[model samples]
Target: GWTYGLNGELRKATRISGIEDFSINVFRRDFGLVPIKVATWGPFVLLNMDNEILQKDNIDTDNVASEWLGSSSELFSLNGVDTTLTYVCRREYIIECNWKVFCDNYLDGGYHVPFAHKGLASGLSLDSYTTSIFEKVSIQSAEGGSKEKEDDRLGSKAFYAFIYPNFMINRYGPWMDTNLAIPLGPRKCLVVFDYFLEASFKDDKAFIERSLADSEKVQMEDIRLCEGVQKGIESPAYSTGRYAPNVEKAMHHFHCLLYDNLIN
Candidate 1:
């Protein structure tokens, strides 16, 4: 059996305005009260086919068991911007690399930023960048300014959050982009970037246009870097390598998750 229901009122409070690239799986089931277990936690609704199985595991469905998902409770807040905005752009790329490789590259955080990304490197102060490990996610952020445009706006902080198994949220100023890595094959992944900005900024054509242009530049740089890494992964001389605990904590955290899940 499967279950689904979010309170009509609570749903509005949790509104994202527009979810953009966020994905959810939906299914339908007929009404039946026989031999099924249902669980409800904060913002999480779960169902299982066997009630006895849940009991045997000492699982309580009615009471909260697991912590909430994602990094925050109010992930889509507008901050200083107007709240009536919606996502306006979605850009996608198909990179010739294993999905894990793509994720590994992302998890490396700013390790390669100063070396591989000239534009991004200029914007990000490498020393000021920081990475943190959470139970189910990791974050890498920095205070930055591009050499071309040095933090012209008050909202110049660059924030990047990664949810396990290839979901990424990045915010630079009033613009936010979510990246989803979808595996296509053993060594291919489809990555999508869905961009959102403050509704008030929509009227400022120059800002929006420049933002998109700069975003494309950053994406292209990442694509090239990832592709090069994919080629390196194919080299027979290389197998696996170590990580810098101080710098690549997020990458290390992701690998731990992968190992733990595989062990199960």
Candidate 2:
């Protein structure tokens, strides 16, 4: 059974059999009657049903953006520059690596950018690259390089933000894309990419196609690096390695947070 109402008016009740608990409310019926917490920021929607997270105090979705993003919260505000963007395309990539391995590769600042992603590195000022870590977030930013053109793929600035576990939001030039990593097995994962472009550019078919192709090329480069790293980890002779203090701070932060969650 379920009830619907608008502003406490035009109320209606629908009855259904086998529903033993009406008090158990959740946002998705597919998950049964378990309680689900939802929060929205601009065009982003976050849903959580983990009891471990729900048990914590002050879990309000409204405060999540501010708390996790800190000073960067303004970038996602409804009245901000993001408002000019509209969803354009989505892509999925199946990678032969653990979910955490993908995250580690992303959080390694820009250490591997120059060596493994030559095309991508050419558009960014690696010397000026910076990484900032917060309680539950890490941000890496860089300025366009000297060779960047007026209509460059990455524009004049780039920001890559990682939200804890397995989510990433990348904003570069006039484009924005989100990456959601889902684990399929011990060494397999799926990464979903949703791209958005400035509303004004949505009608430019050639531009959109060129942008997507460039993005796919970079992703393919990353996939090779991640898969190789996973294979190395599985080697019997593989032992613990040291992190590059200046470049791998965010990766270290991720490992620490993952350890805390697993042990607790």
Tens digit per residue, CA lDDT, model 2, 1-264: 444443222233355434665323432333333456666666676676778876665467768678556666765452233556799979999999999999999999899999998888888888888888887778888888775243366888788888888989888877889999999999999999999888878998998999899999999999999999999999999999999999998899899999999999
Off by over 4 Å in 2: 1-35, 50-62, 67-72, 75-81, 147-151
TM-score of every model versus the real structure = 0.71, 0.81
Candidate 1, residue 195: the lDDT equals 78
Go through the candidates in order and give each one's C-alpha lDDT: 0.68, 0.81
Cα misplacement distance, residue 176 of candidate 1 (Å): 0.6
In terms of lDDT, the best-performing candidate is 2
- The superposed Cα distance between candidate 1 and the true structure at residue 94, in angstroms, equals 0.6
* Candidate 2, residue 99: lDDT: 99
